[model samples]
Target chain A: MTVPDPRFSLNQWTTRHWPIPDLVSGCVARGVRGVGLWREPVAEYGLARTAKLMGDEGLTVTSLCRGGFFQEKDAIAENRRAIEEAAELGTPVLVLVSGGLPEGSRDIDAARARVAECLAELAPYAGSHNVQLAIEPLHPMYASDRCVVSTLGQALDLAAPHPPEQVGVVIDTYHLWWDTAAYDDIARAGAEDRLAVFQVADWVTPLPEGVLTGRGMLGDGCVELRRFREAVEATGYTGPIEVEIFNEELWAMPGPDALTLTLDRFAEHVV
Target chain B: MTVPDPRFSLNQWTTRHWPIPDLVSGCVARGVRGVGLWREPVAEYGLARTAKLMGDEGLTVTSLCRGGFFQEKDAIAENRRAIEEAAELGTPVLVLVSGGLPEGSRDIDAARARVAECLAELAPYAGSHNVQLAIEPLHPMYASDRCVVSTLGQALDLAAPHPPEQVGVVIDTYHLWWDTAAYDDIARAGAEDRLAVFQVADWVTPLPEGVLTGRGMLGDGCVELRRFREAVEATGYTGPIEVEIFNEELWAMPGPDALTLTLDRFAEHVV
Candidate 1:
């Protein structure tokens, strides 16, 4: 039997229903050497305990799921805590989903400005913790209520004001596939050494109401997933390739079943 | 009683159920000087009759909704018929929704290439009719199932190889507001004289299933409608500003009432 690629990381969200301890064992059983974790589950499981559990299982925490939401109140403090969490977890990267426009606010420019301000404050704290802030530009559909940073180019621009070691950008196929400039931006990200994390998901259509939780399982939709992995690899990013999907049906399955299906898809479509 | 701006053209789809004659008379009564039309309604009313009615009502046809589903089997022949219809209606702009990937296809790059080929075939026919082929890039969310052309930059790039008089791009705020490069692309469109038509519609979240028909009435969402208008005008584009909305609630209302509400919203938030 072929061993799973060591670079393959199952983002905790892919098996969102899986408890931390089970997730660790499941990854080990399936030969998934790394994982991209979310803060909520880690805190719920006790961050230190979760860290020890992963260490015991020889599982590397690839990156923390998120830390931005700058439009929220006390964003800097919140992100600082996130950086500390990444440090404690021994993850080298923290994903940032920069929040959207403030409620009832039409000025996206102002909201984007606030993100920069929050990042400026948190970058130093993140650097001290040795955690690189990875700006993940959510698809443009989420620009209003999720993240105003809607393009990989914009994410790279946001990270420009910070040290490359302290700040970087994420390359997610589901979000960036539709962008015509994605290839050029990917090259730019690589050349600048800002390609921190790589993610894969396909783009399925007739997006459900709210358009969240409708992400496609790899190979079940239209995204060119392997191409994105190759692009990031071209950038010398010999790091984790996280399968981050947010499908409702995927969550309804038993955690082990879901991970099994995801690993199969990841091997077939992504790696 | 404030006068309606002469540049405000009520697009037929904004009041989708309104008959052609009723739409023309309603615009005339409201002091609206222009009307943007769709091909289906024009055909249903008889193209000659619709044209004569608009002429009798002194309502200019600002543009014809579309002429480009390039992925369809009969796309070229069908687009030729559309160009003929636009010429018959005396409209100078033929909006092109270049269509999505061929069914079950994942190669967006190839789909985009097909759009260019179709444009090359249609540009001269459209030019002969004195109708500009205006490529309208729908928001990226529609990239998979609606239009592969998902950005103003890509639209402009597609239009670049053609004569400015023959091929141009549409600036629709509803489809473009989330883009960070929108302003720059708008300026580029104007500089190249490829700014053929300007459209407005607010974007409301909780996108309905299918993610279409969820467009907001102006001022009812987060888009900066006036800013988009100003950006287009800044490009020396003095053409009619088409109010093109596709909301189920707006479509369900009485045509005259919807038109009245649209005029009010336009004056308050978009002028």
Candidate 2:
């Protein structure tokens, strides 16, 4: 049997319904060596137990799913806890989905400023935990509700003030593929040593209602996945390429079947 | 009765079902001095008849809705005819929604280049007709299917090659309000004399399926409508401000009532 690509990391959300033990064993069975863990699932499974299980199975915790929803009142304290969790899990990266506008707020600039401020507040704590904060810019469609950071350049700008080891930006193909400046920003991210986690997902059309779960599977949509992978690699990024699709159909499939499909597509289209 | 804001123009698609004759008379009755026309409705109403009706009613045609699906085989010829129609209707701007990536094609760069090539072919014809081909950069969400030009800066870049009077850019607030560089691009457009048309539609969340007809009514969402207006005016743009919403609920209203609400919203939230 062919071993899975060494760089292939399954983001937990890809097989969201899979029980923790089943997901770990399924990844092991498939020879997938890396997994990005979401905070909720890790917490639900008992963080220490999840960490011990991955460690025992010789799997690397590639990154913790997220830590930045600065729009919330308790965001800083919550992110502090998230940083500690990442440290306990032995992951080097913590992804940040900066929350969008405050309730009924038309002031995007203020919201963005708040993200920068929150990063400054949390960077030291994250750095002390040896976890790099990876700011993930969502697609512009989610600019109002999900994430205010809507471009890689904007993410880089937000990360500029922080130490590269403490705060960096995520280059998710699904979000940045539409940006004309993405390639340049990728090169910039590398030059500045700010490239953190690289996530893969495809862009599909006629986006579903609420526009959140309609992410296309790798190789299924028009996104130049291989090209994006090469671009990130060309920027000296040798990090695990996390498959983070959010398609409902894919999620409906049994976890192992979905993993097999994703592995095949990732090999065919991304790597 | 108070006259509608003199700069206000109702894009016909905002009242998609309003009959042309009724729409014309309704605008006249409501003191709306300007209206933007769409190609299909104008063709159905007879382009010459629509022109004559608007002229006879002393109403200005703010713009001809669009003319730039360069992905189509016969785009140049179609746009040439659109230019002639815009000339006949006495409108100075022809809004161009540069078509999306061709069927199953991922070469956005090539699609964008096609827009430039088509512009080169149509600019002279449009210039001779006293009409500017206004490339309207859609929101990034529409980048794949509706228009490849997805940022005001990119629209300005595309317009840079042609004479400002012959080729320009459309600043639709609904498409550009999320862009951080939109304000700067507006200033650049003004400096370059490339601001041809200004349109408005608010953006509400929970985007419906397809995401096309989900534009919010003015003042109903988070857009800073009046601020966007000030930014345009600050750039010396004194042209018509077209209200071009596409909400299903708005379309279901009586045309007159919709017009009244829009005018009221414009006065309260946009002017």
Candidate 3:
């Protein structure tokens, strides 16, 4: 049983190779339901202008791509700014890829502690603005210099200590398909009513650039997407299953073609 | 206190570019204690000649490089040959990288079932030959297509259905450091008296080919080598630590230089 597409959201970066109006008109013309954008694209288009543009196209801003990077000392002010922006755009969830191990810090536990403390402080400000903070666990290969929340279990452990409803976790397959704990974590999150988003991507070989460039488009690698969707759905998470792939190749392709391909594959495999 | 050098065993392939006798002589001249020659080397040198050469050099075959690939239809015959090879080398532990999912099969759980069942059949043969089988939990990236056992916990679980003393697991850093479950699994294995083998290697970025040729020489990456050594040592299994890296760049270097580099790094980071 395939789930119907939410049909509109265009992650701005997905269309970064294209212009904002092009992406909006493309989505609106094709009956896509909403848009998920980032700070830079919104800034480039001017936030209010972007908001007005989305409003004019009847597109909902599902999420804003960022806000955390809590491991850095200067992260505080920047994160505060992100919260303000999310409030401005009225993004329901502000996705946060917590920064990796601080330079010269060998202690991962301490890094986790740092992120948790930072999030606790940031969460209240976000809650006040009704902007939910979602922690995204990047892959473990990124443990040293990227997100320290490398597993769903670790993310949940960090999240459980915070207020239940104000903060949650984002399930991005590219960052997590390798995790052995994923199935359990997805169910656990849904049971807790905190599965903010479920994202899909594949795991291709010859990992490019080592960080973000290697994210495979859906069905391009070995991930069992339907099983992941089943795991999430079994927990009653009926919300949008976000297709948020960070693929250099796909981005280079025409935006509409990529969206069409993603939607087509999403329907066939992930739902 | 650091343990004395436990005879450097030449993992046959480490010096595949050289003949078995010459590789052993080179290792012995450099103060290496042993050589873990493979079946191909033994076949070329003649098993008796290989054994005599190592015997003449006062080297110990700590463990054979491998034995398992047991998921095949012809597994019993293949495993029996592996037993004979281990017996010939007088190697105590036959390292087994429990291979990845079988082609035409999508159920990883079922693939794991095949491993356990095959191991049960192979265990009797190994026991008869007094050959200990060591399961290696390869890195999770290799989980889908290389080893179904991707964590020490899963390896332990597979081992659980067998005798702890006969069936053990190799904690190879190159295959396992990224695993968050390593510390806990090592501790648990130590408690269970099943800490089989400890292999060390560094993880260089942009993992070469995503298959082979990317393993860093020890001390080249951010792996907490000493921390892992301490964790494994706490398990009371202070066996020889093997430095195993399959790097094309290192391979291009003279074998003796590579050996020296590996040994020096082992002393500084792992001893």
Candidate 4:
């Protein structure tokens, strides 16, 4: 078998049921060098232990899953904690899924404003931790109950005020592939020096209920993965390309098998 | 109870199973003076017969359901026939749900280019029929398999190359609500005189599978219906505000009851 691409990083959520210890071993067995981790799992696995384990296994923590959700009452405090966690884990990036509109509220403008405010509050904290806050604009379907930030353009606009070292943007293929302005925005993101993380997942039809957890495996749907990768690379972004599929079927597979499948598809469709 | 808003026009798909005759009589009884027609039901009831019936009942045909599916091989010929049908039905507006990328195709740019080309070919014919083709951008979630046009800005851009009277854009709250630039685009649509139709359907979450038929009733979701209506009116658009919903629950309700609920909600939440 061909050697796995050096830039390949498996997002922990891709193998949702994979135990932390086994996942570390699986990555090591496959010669995978990086991992994108989630907060809940790391907290459950003990942050220091997870960090020590990754260090022992020689696996780099590419990023922490999320930090934004500004609509929540304690969002600022929560995000500060998340920033500290990222610092402890040795990840340079903390992905932010800025929360959706407040409950029963139609004032999306207000919710978006809150995200900016929260970001300003957290950017300095993140900067002190040496962690760049990567604002991830989710697909528009998640605009109501998930992230109000729904396009790369919006994310860049929101990140504009902060220093590039403290604030940046993620270019996730699944969420952004459908946007007409994505490529243009990708170039703008690069020009602005806001390219922080690059995640890959395909866009499949008949989105499941709640429109979450249905992200297609690499090459299983219609996203132009390689084109997206090339676009980011063209922008001079040589970051870890995290394979972040959130499909039920893929999650059910053995972690090693899933990683094997993802590695193969990554080579075929993304690299 | 307050009389139904004169501008409220129930779209046929809102009551999918309601027979044309029953729907027509129900509107008249409820004091609703306008309706948005679907080509399928109109054809099933005989287009000429339906037109004559609406004329006899003194109900104006607000707009024809759709005409553009540019990806289909026979799209041009089919749209030409649709223009004729709109003319026969005496509707001045034909809404276009531009189809998604051709099957298995990842070239969205090419698919979008195809839409522009098809519009150029059909605009003159629609103009001749005294029918304006309104480009209706579906929600971005539908960009893959239903409609590539997914924002009001994109719709207005597509309609820009043609005469405003022949080619216009639709403002559907459900599809455009999540867009940060929607209000600005609405103003642009007004200044350009390209606002052909104003449609309303609140956006509720946990979208069912296929994501096609889960549109929320007006006051039932987070959309600021009155703000959207006021924005459209600010554009100097004195056209019908078509209530176009596609929910399985709403469709299962008895026609008159569904119409009653819609009228009540439109008054409470929209006008």
Candidate 5:
């Protein structure tokens, strides 16, 4: 029988309250197929230790939480380190959060130029490792202090000069659901086989913490999850739509409770 | 002598600390000739009352702050009323802050479509009154709650099917500055004669209210005002580069004092 809706994967960030191994185990107990993890936790658990845990617990990593920030005057050394980490995790796609405007700089175009240059320099390193870079266009609020890549189309353009298999985009419904060209961008990425990862989250009300705390739990906000999912699926991306909400309230809840809610919401609203 | 920076104007929301009349007198007092004003104070002062005040004070009403909540069911009626007020104010442009995702609705595309349809319907009404409808692409932070139009490129596309003279964009630095395509959009807007209003404000720390406090006090934030002015001017539309800041702290300050500071920055950084 065809799966009811699509399978739901959980990013540890949504349940940041739990330990990484516990998050892995908790996800498995709840019938979650995959987990998106961060480098620091993996490093803390030791990549070998975490990979072992994921294997024993039978958890599939949807994608790595991120690897980007290719800015600054000399960023080669930093990017190389990130690449090595992604390779160690053995995740299929390494999510890359393109960083924001540098402090004391006013020219975003110049800053974006720096990102493009960094990507070109790091492309060979990323290529050598068999790691794919997924450029996640963050919310525009973070545009000043976070990622400068703000749209899927812009991300596609940045990826154009590089090999699509090497560099692609991560479509988090939270970051891109509001964009006018979101559907078109996803279709184009899928057409080119550069639709690297599918991330799920919601844009919340009252927009807490201004920048970070405001991301809603999937069902809490108004993003059309089914529409967003359909758009990605239409792009021929058969990958899992990972739930990656960055919420404080959800974090305070018990990990299993959050996981249960996430799964339920995924089935009810998204799937 | 050629004006050093002829495109500069003042958006009163920047120095929101000041009363509208004080902002008007201050704009003239400080050699800043154009102004973008919100409706609340105009309503408080009465539109006819404020219009003659602007004329008497020799201030150019660059654009009225807004005239679109185009997503609501009654958006046509709402916008018609807004157009009447904008025309009454004698501002050549009526800035439209597209309302956010309709609460409880998961469909962003549908909301965006509604906004577009509203614009299409209002375009004629605005044209008849000689009020150019300026679609202000709000910061993406507001995508779910406020303006769904979140990029200059998106706004341009929304305005594309309409005549540039009748429909255009409000290139507010606070909103469009974070967009990766801001520069290209600015240049493109100018090329198409759709640069309706060039607003200035600093992207400050998100305030306690969870909104971008409109806190950029001219030189206070990282917006490249000079370069932005240069880019807009290059567009061949020598319209007012209005300083439109929405800072609460600035609003708390005495309006005249805020005006004084706004003018000083306009001369130093903008002009």
Candidate 6:
């Protein structure tokens, strides 16, 4: 059988129940070479231990899940800790989910401005840590309580104030598939060198309660996965394609089983 | 008490359980001079009969609920009938919810293309009937199963090929409050004279199953309802402000009580 694409990386949230050690071993056993980690799991496993585990398994840390929630009271300090974690793990990218509007405030502009301010304070720290801060524009449905950055254009705008290597944007299919200008924005992201991470997750209907978990498995929904992958590749991005689905079913499966299935689907729909 | 604004129109779907007759009397009692209608109820109550009832009550039909669902096999014929109904009811606008991708299909581009083609066929007919086809871009959450058009910008682009008087866009606060580019698009719509209808409904979190009917009461959610009204007015749109909410709790209220509550909230949050 043909091997999985070397650039295919499994995001920790996809198989959330998978223990860190088993996840590493599962990737190695399946010939997977990269992983996108979450800060909580890394912290839980002990940052040093998680980094050593990846090294032992010959796995590269493709990215760290998130760092930006600028609306919080101590956003800078929290983000600094996240940046330190990414640096220690040797991950080049730190995904940012800019928080939603501040409580009881309808002033999205102010909240967005806060994100910019927090970024200014953290960009230098991230640059020094050698981690690229990847601002992820979530789906507009989350604009109220999750992330106010709701378009690739907005994400790129947020990243523009920083150095290309210092700040970038993530292209996640689940959050972006509905955008009519997504293709144009994707091209713009590539041209501006702001396309820091490429994430894959299909969007399914009847979005579950809270609209958080319930992402469709690869090829299970309407997203044109191959087209997105092709677009990112055309932009000269030779980086890991992180499968970051947050479905309950996928998390409930045995870690090895889920990895194997993901590899197969990745080969079929994404790579 | 101050009289309710004459431009405030109640969309039938907002108080869904209220029979058409009760809805009419309720509006007339409240001095509500206009009503937005849904095709199913109008048909169930007999279209011509409903039209006559509105005329007899001296209430105007502001707009018709929908026309486009182009993915269906009979979409063209179906939309033609809707245009005819709007004309018969003497309403100037027929809102269109461009249907989502075909079942089990991953071709959203094709679905969107179908909507444009359907419009190309129906726009002239609608114009001939003295009805403008107003494309309502549903929230992105419904991009897969409900409507492929997810942004006001996209709707405006689709309406661009037609005459402004023949084709226009619907500005729904619930669907668009989260968009960063919404204000600019509103100005563009006004400048282009394509802002055919203005709708208002507050957004609440933890969207109920299907994400269709969880709209918050006007003052119950975080949306800047008055700001949206001002924005639309700034666009020079002097059309009726249609309050179209879809919430189970609101529907369960007595018809007159719901109307009273809506008027109060409209004044408090949207005036």
Per DockQ, the best of the predicted structures is 1
How large is the i-RMS for each model, in angstroms?
0.7, 0.7, 3.0, 0.8, 1.8, 0.9
Candidate lDDT (C-alpha), each: 0.92, 0.94, 0.76, 0.94, 0.79, 0.92
Candidate 2 stretches with Cα past 4 Å from truth are none
Off by over 4 Å in 5: A1-6, A72-74, B1-8, B206-209
Model 1, range A61-121, lDDT digits (tens) per residue?
9999789999989888898899999999999999999999898999999999988888898
User: Which residue pairs overlap in candidate 6's backbone?
Assistant: none
Lowest-scoring 10 consecutive residues by lDDT in candidate 3 chain A? A1-10
Candidate 4 residue-wise lDDT, A195-266, digit = tens: 999999999988888788889998888899999999999999888999898899998899999999999999
Candidate 4 falls in which docking quality class? high
Clash pairs of candidate 4?
none
Error of 4 at A47 (Å): 0.7
Number of colliding residue pairs in each model: 0, 0, 14, 0, 14, 0
Q: What TM-score, over all chains together, does every model reach?
A: 0.98, 0.99, 0.92, 0.99, 0.92, 0.98
Q: Report model 2's chain A TM-score.
A: 0.99
- Residue A210, candidate 4: C-alpha displacement in angstroms: 1.4
DockQ winner, 2 or 4: 2
Model 3 misplaced stretches (Cα beyond 4 Å): A1-4, A7-16, A209-211, B1-4, B7-18, B39-48, B70-73
Tens digit of per-residue lDDT, candidate 5, span A212-235: 876787788888788888988887
Kindly list the per-residue Cα lDDT of model 1 for residues B151-232, writing each as its tens digit. 9999999999999999999999999999998999999999999999999999899899898899999999999998998898
With a 3 Å backbone cut-off (N, CA, C), the pairs that clash in candidate 1 are none
True contacts kept of each: 0.92, 0.69, 0.21, 0.74, 0.67, 0.79
The candidates' DockQ values read: 0.89, 0.84, 0.37, 0.83, 0.61, 0.82
Report how far residue A5 has shifted in candidate 6, in Å: 0.9
Residues forming the 10-long window of minimal summed lDDT in candidate 6 chain B: B204-213
